[model samples]
Target: TSTGKESVNATLPVGLAMVRAIRAYFEETGYLIGFKPAGGISTAKASLDWLVLMKEELGRPWLEPELFRFGASSLLTDIERQLEHHLTGHYSANHRHAMA
Candidate 1:
């Protein structure tokens, strides 16, 4: 499950249910569960998906960005584009260099 809008639009309920099921299975079998929702997460909502999963399933918040990494380089591109758009009222090709 991802926090990205695409994932949310495509199958949010399924993602949430899958997380729940994984949690239940882990609890029943005494297994340590690890879930990584990586890629296509450029929006704040997308980021929140991981937090929601952690809180709902694990009963805690892991707020550290190191633990919850946005896996796609393209996501950074999207963020840069949006920021540039906000600041300049247009997208700039040079914004990519700033990220680097």
Candidate 2:
């Protein structure tokens, strides 16, 4: 319940609450549920923080793709750009990885 600001800070509380709920559910039932931090996750830093939070709160098992996923088109752009820079020592133009 925010003012629709698409910043990471704005999303943090929501993410935290959702993660806590999932963690509690798992602890109470022993049934792991998938979590998707969808939309508005448009930056690599945001995605990284999300992974770290998931690991910290839900443990390393949440790092698996089947357990966590980002549901944004722009996130793919950021990820591809980061991957290219990591693998090739160069960052591609943002437009090059524009979400289709």
Candidate 3:
């Protein structure tokens, strides 16, 4: 977890680097580790950045939901807004995409 207060943009690199080190140390064991960066990520750009970083540092498999997840609901709302803007050419109100 990312302390739920720090940006994933700032923490993801450090986290991925640590994962790489662990993978390097356990290369012979074939250990598969999942990364769940929870909290402090609230922008569509941040979500996309996470995808890119995960793909670059952890390979394509890590992009799977089973391996990677966003921990912030607000982040999802922003993503939905971006998608709506792309598809409809207008951003919807944030309340339209409510999270439970």
Candidate 4:
């Protein structure tokens, strides 16, 4: 059992533990299993935070974006804006696409 705050803080550790346990179970039975965390990640920082968490806890990097996904719409817009600026050499003034 965990307090609300502890549950939040322990999410990554608990998730990694679950992944390892599942992997071990599959390995013992001569099967293969893959795990990926999904949802709620938005900003670049949030995405990077997941990577950091995975690396710190799992001791490996998930280099491919296909292996992990961020579900936030705002993140996609931010990425597009940044890419547009990079290609055009100017930041977009379109507030309609800006993140709230």
Per-residue alpha-carbon lDDT of candidate 1 for residues 5-77, written as tens digits (9 for 90 to 100): 4634324456467667767887799775555565455555565666776676666533455333455445566
- In order, candidate lDDTs are 0.58, 0.80, 0.76, 0.55
Q: Rank the candidates by lDDT, best first.
A: 2, 3, 1, 4
Estimate TM-scores for all models. 0.51, 0.78, 0.80, 0.45
Number of backbone collisions per candidate: 1, 0, 0, 0
Clashing pairs in 4: none
> In model 3, how large is the Cα lDDT of residue 8?
43
> Residues 14-90, candidate 2, lDDT per residue (tens digit)?
78888899999999999998887766777888888888888998998988989987776677888898899999999
Which candidate model has the greater TM-score, 1 or 2? Answer: 2
Clashing pairs in 1: 3-46
Minimum summed lDDT over a 10-residue window in model 3 is located at 1-10
Backbone clash pairs for candidate 2 read none
TM for candidate 4 is: 0.45
Q: Mind giving the per-residue lDDT tens digits that candidate 3 earns over 2-100?
A: 657653434676767866765675576777777777776789888888788878877888889887788877787888888999999999997799851
In model 1, the runs with Cα more than 4 Å from the true position are: 1-11, 61-70, 77-100
* Cα-based lDDT at residue 55, candidate 2: 91
Model 4 lDDT at residue 83 = 74
Best by lDDT, which number?
2
